[model samples]
Target chain A: EAGVAQSPRYKIIEKRQSVAFWCNPISGHATLYWYQQILGQGPKLLIQFQNNGVVDDSQLPKDRFSAERLKGVDSTLKIQPAKLEDSAVYLCASSPGTSGEQFFGPGTRLTVL
Target chain B: DQQVKQNSPSLSVQEGRISILNCDYTNSMFDYFLWYKKYPAEGPTFLISISSIKDKNEDGRFTVFLNKSAKHLSLHIVPSQPGDSAVYFCASRYPGTYKYIFGTGTRLKVLA
Candidate 1:
C-alpha cells in the first residue's frame, strides 16, 4: 500500500514571504493531520481534518497559518509573512480513521531566512 | 505548558541487548499513549502504543508499559538491532479528543 506523500522535500523562503506545503494521504484514509517540528522538539499538532472537515486546529496560528482539505484526499498548509521562527519541518500524516495508527510522509523542510 | 517530556536526550545500547526508553507526562486526562520512531529527514512512524485502561501492550519485540499512578510510560525493545537506532517520541491523547501532544524525542543508538 502507498504511504502518505509530500512534495518539495525542502523549501527555502525569506522572512515576510509566503510558503506552502502539500500532502497526499493514503487511499481510503479518513483522517489527515499537519504538524510542525522545530529543532530539538517533538512534533506539535497544527491542525486535523476529518474528511475535509476540520476536527481540531486550536494550536494553529490563525494570524499567519492556514490549511485546507477540500476533497478529503489531499491537503495544503500555508504560512504568510513567514518569520524566522517558522523555519521548521512540516509533516503530514493520515490514519484509517479517528483513533487509528497514523502513517507519515517524508515531510517538507521549510527554511525561513 | 509542556505536558509531556522525555528527560533523556540520548541513549546507547549494544546490539542484541534490551533497550528501554522512558517518558513522563503531567496531565491526568491523557487516556492513550504511543511511541513513534523517526529518522533524519523523515516523519515519525508509529512504533507501539498502550491505552490507559491497559497496563501493558506487547508486539513481537516491542512492548509498552503504562503507569497511571506515576504518570509515566516506557517502551522496551528486546534484543535491539542496529537498524533500530533512531529518535523515539512519546505522544498522548486525551479521551474524546483527536489532538495528541508529543514530547521532545529521545535519540537511541544501538551499536553493533
Candidate 2:
C-alpha cells in the first residue's frame, strides 16, 4: 500500500514570507498529523486532525501557523511571516485512528533565509 | 519538561556485535512505547513496540525491554549490520492520549 504523501519535498523562503505545505495521507486513514523537526531534535507535533475536525493543536503557534483538513483526506499547513527559527522539516503522518501506529511521509524541508 | 530522553547522542559498534540504545521517560502514565529508525533524508519508520504490561518484546534481531519500575526502556540490535546504521527514536503514549512524546534520538553507526 502507498504511504503518506507530501508535496514540495524542499522549500526555501525569505524571512517574513509566507509558506505552505501540503499532505495527502494514506488511503482509508482516519487521522492525520503535522510535526516540526529541528536539527538534532525529535519531531514535535504541531497539530492533529481526526477526519475533518481537529483533535489537538495546543502546540501550534496560533500567531502565525495554521492548518486545515477540509475533506479529511488531505491537509495543508501554512506559516505566515515565517521566521528564521522556523527553518526545519515539516513531516506529515497518518494512522488508522487515535492511538494507532503512524506512517510518515518524506517531509518538506523548509529553509528560511 | 522533557518527557522522554535518549542520553546517548551517538554510538558506534562493529558489525556482528550487539548494539544497545537506552531511553528514559519521566511520565508514569505512558502505557505504550515504540521505537523508530530513520535514515538520513528519510522519515522515521516504525521498528517495534511494546505495551506496558509486557516487559519484553522481540522481532527478528531486534528486542525491546521495558522496566516499569525504573521507567526505562531499551532497544537491542544483535549482529548489527551496516544497514542498521540510523537514528533511533523512542516514543511513549499514554493510554487515553492521542499524542506521543518522542526522545531527542540516538544515532547508531555499525562499522564494517
Candidate 3:
C-alpha cells in the first residue's frame, strides 16, 4: 500500500514571504495531521483533520498558520508572513482512525531567509 | 510544560550489543505509548506500541517496557545492527484525544 504523500520536499523563502505545503494521505485513511519539527526536537502537532472537519488545532499559531482538508483526502498547510523561526520541517501524517498507528510523509523542509 | 521527554540525546553501541533508550512522561492520563524510528531525511515510521494495561510488548528484536508507577518506559533493541541506527521517538496519547505528544527523540548509533 502507498504511504502518505507530500509535495515540494524542500522550500526556501524570504522572511515575511508566504509558503504552502500539500499532503495526500493514504487511501481510505480517515484522519490527517500536520506537524512542525524543529531541529533537535520532535514533531509538534499543528492541526488535525478528521475527514473534512478539524479535530484539534490548539497549538497552531493562528496569526500566521492555517490548514484545511476540504475533501477529507488531501490537505494543505499555509504560513503567511513566515518568520525565521518557522524554518523547519513540516510533516504530514494520516491514520486509519482517531487512535492507532500513523503513516508519515517525507515532509517539506522550509528554509526562511 | 514538556509532558514527554527522552533525557538521552544519543547513544552508541557496538554491533551485537544491546541498546536501551529511555523515556519519561508526566501525564498520567496518557493511555497509549508508541515508538517510532526515523532515518535522516525520512519521516518517522511506527515501530511498536503498547497500551496502558500491558507492562511489556515485544516484536522481533525490539521490546518496549512500561512502568506505570514510575511513569517511565523504554525501548530495547537486542543485538543491535547497523540498519537499526536511527532516531527513536517516544509518543503518548490520552485515551480520548487525537493528539500524540512526542519526545525530543534519542539517536542510536550501532558501530560495526
lDDT string, candidate 3, A1-113, tens digits: 99899988999999999999999999999999999999999999999999999999999999999999988899999999899999999999999895578999999999999
lDDT string for model 2 (B56-105, tens) is 99999999999999999999999899999999999998677668888999
Estimate the lDDT of model 2.
0.94
Q: What's the CA RMSD of model 1 in angstroms? A: 0.9
| Candidate 2: C-alpha RMSD after superposition | 0.9
Question: Model 2 chain B: which ten-residue window has the lowest total lDDT?
Answer: B93-102
State which candidate has the highest DockQ: 3
What is the TM-score of each predicted model, taking all chains together?
0.97, 0.98, 0.99
Candidate 1: residue A90 Cα off by (Å) = 0.3
- Name model 2 segments beyond 4 Å from true: none
Q: Give the TM-score of candidate 3.
A: 0.99
Model 3, residue A18: C-alpha shift (Å): 0.5
- Give model 1's TM-score for chain A to 2 decimal places: 0.97
Instruction: Give the clash total for candidate 1.
Output: 0
Candidate 3 Cα outliers beyond 4 Å, as residue runs: none
Angstrom error of the Cα, residue A57, model 3: value is 0.3
lDDT of 1: 0.94
Deviation in Å, model 2, residue B28 alpha carbon: 0.3
- At residue A82, candidate 1 shows an lDDT of 99
Q: Which candidate is the best by lDDT?
A: 3
Which is the better candidate, 1 or 3, if ranked by TM-score? 3
